[model samples]
Target: MDKRLLDILCCPVTKSPVRLLAENELLALNRAIAADQVLNGAGARVTGAFSGGLITRDARTIYRVEDDIPVMLADEAVATSQLTDFPRS
Candidate 1:
């Protein structure tokens, strides 16, 4: 992800700034995904592994990045609260 683009991108719902998910955060998310414990805002099971993600500044939601494109749709957002042992810092 480009720093410039990231700097300009914000969560569509909260209007809060977003940043790239850290390695630990990504790991935790993927782990949950692999275990079939992840779901999107629309209440659909999130399948497969994500290459990367953009997390809201408040750390409440995560938007997946597929093929280097940010899927910034609200329904596609994943609530960070669902992941067990998710990173805090």
Candidate 2:
């Protein structure tokens, strides 16, 4: 992700600053996704693996990044609280 773009990106709903998802966190999320255990805020199952993602500073929400573009829509957001064992750091 570009530094300038990331610096200005924020969660659409909470308006919280966003940052790149960490390696460990991404791995964990992918694992859950593989198991068909992940869903978006809209209650739709997230079937595809994210190539990259951005998470809110508070770690409450996650937005998938596809082809270097962040899917910042509220309905597309994933709530970290739903993950069975999400890493906070």
**Over 4 Å off in model 2, which ranges?**
none
Q: Looking at model 2, which ten-residue stretch has the lowest summed lDDT?
A: 80-89
Deviation of model 2 at 31, angstroms: 0.6
Measured against the true structure, the TM-scores of the candidates, in listed sequence, are: 0.96, 0.96
Highest lDDT: give the candidate number: 1
For candidate 1, the per-residue lDDT at 63 reads 98
Give the TM-score comparing model 2 with the true structure, all chains together.
0.96
What would the C-alpha RMSD of candidate 2 be, to one decimal place?
A: 0.8
What is the lDDT for 15 in model 2? 93
lDDT of 2 by residue, 3-81 (tens): 9999999998989999999988888888889999999989999999888899999998999999999999999998999
Stretches of candidate 1 exceeding 4 Å from the true structure:
none
Please report the TM-score between candidate 1 and the true structure: 0.96
